[model samples]
Target: MAETIVVDPITRIEGHLRIEAVLDNGVIRQASSSGTMVRGIEIILRGRDPRDAWAFAQRICGVCTLVHGIASVRSVEDALHYPIPANAQLIRNLMIAAQFVHDHVMHFYHLHALDWVDVVSALRADPQKTSELAQSLSSYPQSSPGYFKDVQAKLSRFVASGQLGIFANGYWGNPLYKLPPEANLMAVAHYLDALAWQREVVRLHTVFGGKNPHPNFVVGGTPSAISVGPSSQASNSGTALNMNGLAIVQDVIRKMQAFVEQVYLPDTLAIAGYYKDWFKKGEGVGNFLTYGEFPSEGKSIDDLSSLMIPRGIIVDRDLTKVQEVDLRAPEQIQEFVSHSWYDYSTGKNAGLHPFQGQTNLHYTGPKPPYEHLDSEQSYSWLKSPRWKNKVMEVGPLARVLMMYATGNKPARELVGMALSKLDLPTEALFSTMGRTAARTLESKLIVDEMQAWYDQLMANIRAGELETFNEALWEPSSWPAEATGVGFTEAPRGALAHWIVIKNGVIDNYQAVVPSTWNAGPRDTLGQDGPYEAALRGTELADPKQPLEILRTIHSFDPCLACAVHVTDPNGEELLQINVT
Candidate 1:
């Protein structure tokens, strides 16, 4: 008989997720991914002003807050045929790039690093050796022996106090952890450093958007104004993004670039060197997709001609040919809820495009705190998103592979350098470890490009082209009676697209196909597993009781279930409740 293992509320991720795996002789025979909450945010969007969608959508996930806002406003703009000024585009690029750097670093150090680093092991590490290891990795000035000793003492005190806090409930001392003591110490110290660094980097978002988390976004342009004069509205009011504020933004960008180069990149490579075997495992679906983001000059929202990140599909693990993604075609993208806790008006078995998508709850799994999920029944709240009805992996790996396959110069050079350092081939870029490293490389790529964007914006402003907002299509009278458009961008997690249908200036229907939805959705109507389930299949477990190996693969995609799904109950009553031992 095959045994079932359950990992509910996978700790440290943004939101709740339950993974059920069937093990046959210590190997995963099958896996199921479930989002235990319902995301009715789309329902909340109905009948609202199309321009206000960004505010509500941005609440989808606090961790990836700004991404939804960006996509939401872009959707409205696309629908209205509105075009923002060039400076607005560059500012948006800077904001999105800042998010990638901030979010990826946090995911690596705070969320995913613990999966590989044993906190207890760091206690046994010598502070001097830890400093030496850190110094060898990068020129990040915090690699002193005293710094490591201080971090170790803090860890020691936390352990002695018996309150591990965030460090609690981890699978410590698990045989699966491969990092040596010194490496563990170095990672832990940088983990703390990242906490401080993130605070400074997020100031970039505040300068542009007026605040962090859900930043303000207008359909035509950003809410920020350019101010060069002392009596300018922004200068007098001391609002962010003023002339003085622009200097601060430049400083933040410099800090972001420094940290990515010094700490994030080196740390990822150093730690990954210990678990190189992981480069061969956790390959899923063998299909990658990216909607393509970071537009350069001459790139329109609907076209991929000048996108810094190319948009295409690589299927069956073949990187030789890239397929073009057509979001407007009815048959191109569809969502299936066959294994999900929802019903479609047409039928549960039918696949619906975003313009015609529906969300109706119909939970049909074992009650909460149940021992195991019935894999044959509805299991998740996430709808399986398919491109041409094929399971696809997205996120950093997809972007990296797309750039590599297209012979992108910078991507090729960076990937080549990293692979040569690890003594691995291009094939190694297909696994779990590769996904994590790709995220690091992506941060560098985005940050390096930030300088050019900033320079362009400054030049445009100096040349008397300070326009940011485009009011040509701001009036409701300017739009057609009925219009539909899709806003697509590459979020930090992966490909994200939001579809909106507007009638009489009100949102008729809205559907967001988030990155996590692509990666963590349940099995589709055709019985094909999603990326999460596909990656879990055939994974070997060193200890069934402590499934660290399972987490390594799942977290590599940086699962954000909150962005994938969300919820509450009616009439002040809990739908289902259970106590687990």
Candidate 2:
């Protein structure tokens, strides 16, 4: 008898996903990850000025929309070889940092916490005890006894308001939720605090991008002008000696720095201690990868004038045994459409870059046509991406290992400190739990760097390096008529890259190999499963109908929509295509 488990419309995260697991005994034998809703943004981008692509791409995802804007601009810049000033680099970094802080905090509390902390359990919490715990954790914000009572009262009111839309049909009261009622109450209180903090960080983007959800950044530099005297030309001039504008952004970053160190990091550690089992379970793809990030001052990883973290791949039984990366090598990356709706030549060995990409949806039945394919193609619109012609994992696990191997001293030291805090031996960094811990650890490192960068900007400003912006775009002819460039950056989840081909001032071809394409991919031609697919095979299902364990494991990676992946239904009314710039 095949055991069947179903999770209808998974809650707490963006978009829609439904999981149906076919089980043999207590283990998942087959799993289906369904993409539940349709949002047509790509179809919307067609026939518009490629210049407006970033603006529309940003709307594809509200949480990481800035990344889309950044990627879009980078793609254009790549096509043009537009050189951005030092000030522009600093400004872009600041915007990305703000998004990182905002996304991580909201993800932890608003989305993932309800799975671990029982909301209904909070009703039994003692307000006095909660206050005492808060006081004990000095890293957290100070609150008086009455403040704790007020927080509890507000939570009660909010709950009674019947506005638990985010928490609707949550996994509350599940036995898997292990935190005590007091702990749950404390977390619930922090959830509210996180909401406010997230809003504050979002301002960092507003100051730079003009709006949240999607901000505007120019190809040559930022849209905002640096204030230096009355003339607009002076605003775009480099700060050869002045340092005023850099200081403004630097100060804002400092505020965020203090919050993460004194609040966010400590909070994650505290929460992790209560959920120690996560360290052992849900470990997928021990091999790690990073496309490098945040270029160091004066160094270019791939010959790009801008600073980049570095790019490399590591596969070893031991974490320390990892090696350097070679992104230039062909055959390292491949895309499989065997089970997808697309029509492609079978077993063809060729580079299928995004510009030469193909996405033609076909449906023969619920079951895919290929013999190696799934019995039911009832799920996601995302196609599986593989490395070295095989499915490989991506994200924190990949980033942590890469950072540990090729990153600066600070990144390495931060990883070391995280391992120590978890009480696992230093070598334990090689496990699944280490991946989760690495993200929290790596975030701290990024936060610290952001603060220092801010201080550097301010110091330069105080030295009279203040300017509003750069005007590299003034001479459009400076750009080549035909060019190809790759824009790669570290999104909050993992490595993200965009490749663009430009001809006659328009995007001849554009492609994005998103983080999800690597982590959530399906099986390849060789019959090997992707990271998410492999991870699901070993998970024990208590009830096939409600597999919380599987959901918890897969969601840890936090999959985002891939712009290049699309499903088409010829019979449907006009094929839901989105276009907004």
Candidate 3:
């Protein structure tokens, strides 16, 4: 007999996620992932200006703030064949790169670190030993014994109050956590350091986009104009894109690169030295997908060759040949609702492409506040997004593998180095720890290339190329009666795209296939489990109650259910619908 272990509302993630793992003989026999909420940004976009969609769509998830704007604006641009200025493309690249570095660091340290590091165990670590461990790893500035002592003292206070604060609700004494006390203390200290590091680095977004966390964006290009003058537009507010802002942006990139090299990358490798078993677990559908991201300045988006990260499909762990991906092909990508809480006109078993995508809400799963979700039927709010009718994993692992398969020298060197350091084979890249390690590897690769992008921008400014926005397709009079487009970006989590149907200058239909929807969605019509479910299969539990092993694998993908799936009551009644004027 198998017993189902339900972990409702998986903590430290972006949105509502419930994991139901059926355990037999202390091993996971089957797993079903459920996104407990749904979002209607697609429905809200209908009948609105396509240009204004980014404003509403950007609110899809605060953590993935500027990405939606990038995808939305690009979808409209793709539809209209709109071309932006070279400098605008450079700025967008820089901003997107920053988002990746920032989001990845935050996810690893804050959201996923506790799964490995025990804060309660950190209190028992000797400060001197911790300082030595940190020094052996990287030349990070905060590795002094006194610094570790102070951090431990601070952590002690959190425990002393019978409240661990952010470190609360953790299975602190779980046997699955293998990191020694010294390593745990080192990780805890760096976790605090990353918190401060992120605070200053996000100013890069403010410098380029005029604000962080849902930065202002324009359809044609960036919103800010390059102003060398002191009295430029918004100069009084310090939001002007002037020499001062440019200098700050430069400094931010340098600081970001330094942190990744010194703290984030080394920390991951050091902590990973203890948990080698994880490299064998959490391997889900060997097939991977990527939209390919980070284009060069002045390069057209149509030129896939210009992308630093090559986009392609790796089917069944075959790294020898990378398959080409076409977003416009209707048969290549489609969404199914067979096991999700939505409906299609063609019926529950049919799949619909984004151009013909619909967002008709329907709930057939057990009502909320219930014990178990009947996985035999609709069990999740997320629609299963499949590429060529095949399940694929997305995110850092896919992107890294894409880069490696495409023969990117830097990625290859980094991947080889990480493998050598871990004493693991290439096959290990498919595991739970592999997904987490790929993130750090790609972050360093992207940051290493950031200097050139900054230098090019400075050269462009010197050459008097100051335009950011293009006005060719700015007005409705210049637009066609009907047009359709797709915009994509390799978001921090994975490949994210927004599709739009523009009619008479207004959005007629819209669909967004977020990364989480591809990963966290329930089973498809073929009865194949999503990445979350597939990864959980075969994972054994030490203590069924604690289930720390489950958290380790799931957190590797860094679930963002808020962006993946929705909103509504279980009774089929709209609880709240505010019409935005």
Candidate 4:
């Protein structure tokens, strides 16, 4: 008999996720990934002003706050055929690049490192040996023996105090841990460094958008204006985009570059050396997709050739040929909710594109606090999203593969370097570890590119080009009676797109197929498993009780369920509530 194991409320992720796997003699025979919440943000956007979509859409996920805001404004701009100034385009590029670097560093060190680094073992590491190993990796400037000693002492005090704080509830002594105590101590030290580093880097968003999470965005262009003089209305008394502000932005970009080169990239290669075997496991749905982002020129969105991250699809692990994606094609992108807690007016088995998507809740699984889900019926809140009727994996791996396939120089160089360092072939870039390393390499690529963008913005400013917002399409009466558009971008996790329909300058319909929805969705109407389930199907668990292997693969995708589903109650009353300390 195949015994079932349930891991509900998977910890250290953004929102609630439950994984059910059937183990036959220590090997996973099958698996299911479920999102336990429902999101009605789309429903809330209906009948609202199109200009206000960015404000509401940004609230989709607290972690991925800025991506949604950018997508929302782009959707409205695409619908109205609004063309923003070149300076605005450059500023937007810089902000998005900062978000990628900041998010990837935080994800690797804070969110995903504990899975590989055993904090309990760090106390046993000799601080001198750890310093030697850290110095061998790169000149990070904080690799002194005293620094490691302080970090190890901090870990010891936490253990002795019986209050682990964020380190609580971790599987600290799992046998699968591969890094030496020295390596573990090094990772822990950088993890603390990243926390302070991210706080300073995010000021780029604050300088440009006036806030960090949920930054302000406009439909026509960015909300920021170039500061030419103190008398300019856009320039405030404290500090705006003035010369001092520009210098601060430049300094932030340099800091981001240094961290990726010294701390983030070198740490990934060193840790990857210890777990080369992981490069062969957790390969999910070889099909990859990216909507392409960061336009290199001030061109129309229709011109895919100018994008820094090329848009295309790779099927069945074939990289020789790239299939073009058409977001406007009705049959290209569709969502199916057969195994999800939702109904479509068309039919339960039908697939609807975002323009015609529906969100009618229909929960039929066992009620809350249950031991196991009845997998035969609706088992999750996430709908299965498919491209051309096939499961596709999206995120760093997808973008990196797309860049390599398209002959991108920077992507190829970085990937080639990382693979050479680990002594692995290109094929190794398809597994769980590859997914994590890809995020790091992509960060370096983006950080390098940021310098060119910043230089361009400065050149434009020196040339006296200060326009940022396009007010030509600000009037509601200027739009046609009905218009629809799709905004697509490559988020830190994967491809994110928002589709909107406008009637009389008001939103008639809105739908977002977030990156997490693509990776964490449930089975489709045909009973085919999504990426998360497919990845876990054949994984070998060393210890079924701990199941650390399961978390390794899932966290590689950086699952963000909060973006996929939201809370709702059809009975018009609070179903359940709890107070936490």
| Predicted candidate 3 versus true structure: per-residue lDDT over 1-581, tens digit per residue | 78989888788999888999999999999999999866888888999988899999999998987999999999999999999888888899888999999999999999999999988999989999999889988888899999999999999999899989889899988888889999999999989999999999899889888788998999898987888666455486455588888999889999998899999999999888898888999998999999988887657666789999888999999999999889989999999999877678789899999999988755444544546888998788899999998998999999999999989999999999999999999999999999999999999999887888888888998899889999888998999999999999999999999999999989998999999999999999999999999999999999999999889899999899889975454365753232222
Find the 10 residues in a row with the least total lDDT in model 3: 572-581
Deviation of model 4 at 330, angstroms: 1.0
- Expressed as tens digits, the lDDT of each residue in 1-581 for candidate 4 is 68999887787789889999999999999899989756689889999999999999999888876999889988998888888898888888888889889999999998898888888889999999999999998988999999999998998999999988778888998888989999999999999999999999998998888887888888888877777775455456443477767888999999999999999999998888888999999998899999998888455455689888999999999999999898888898999988887678888899999999876655544445445766777778888999989998999999999999999998999899899988899999999999999999999999999999999889989999888899999999899999998888788889999999999878998999999999999989888889999889899899888999999999999999989874366775553332223
Off by over 4 Å in 4: 230-240, 297-300, 362-369, 574-581
Alpha carbon deviation, residue 86, candidate 4 (Å): 0.8
Worst 10 residues of 2 by lDDT: 367-376
Candidate 1 residue lDDT tens string, 237-321: 6553667778888899899999999999998998889999999999989999999888885245555677899999999878889
Model 3: colliding residue pairs: 37-566, 38-566, 38-567, 39-566
lDDT (Cα, 0-100) at 247 in candidate 2: 46
Q: Tell me the TM-score of each prediction against the true structure.
A: 0.97, 0.86, 0.97, 0.97
- Report model 2's TM-score to 2 decimal places: 0.86
lDDT of each: 0.88, 0.62, 0.90, 0.88
lDDT score for residue 443 of model 4: 95
List the candidate 3 regions with Cα displacement exceeding 4 Å: 230-239, 362-369, 566-581
Q: Write the per-residue lDDT of candidate 2 for residues 482-546, one digit (tens) a residue.
A: 77666777777777776666666666655566777677655555655666666666677665545
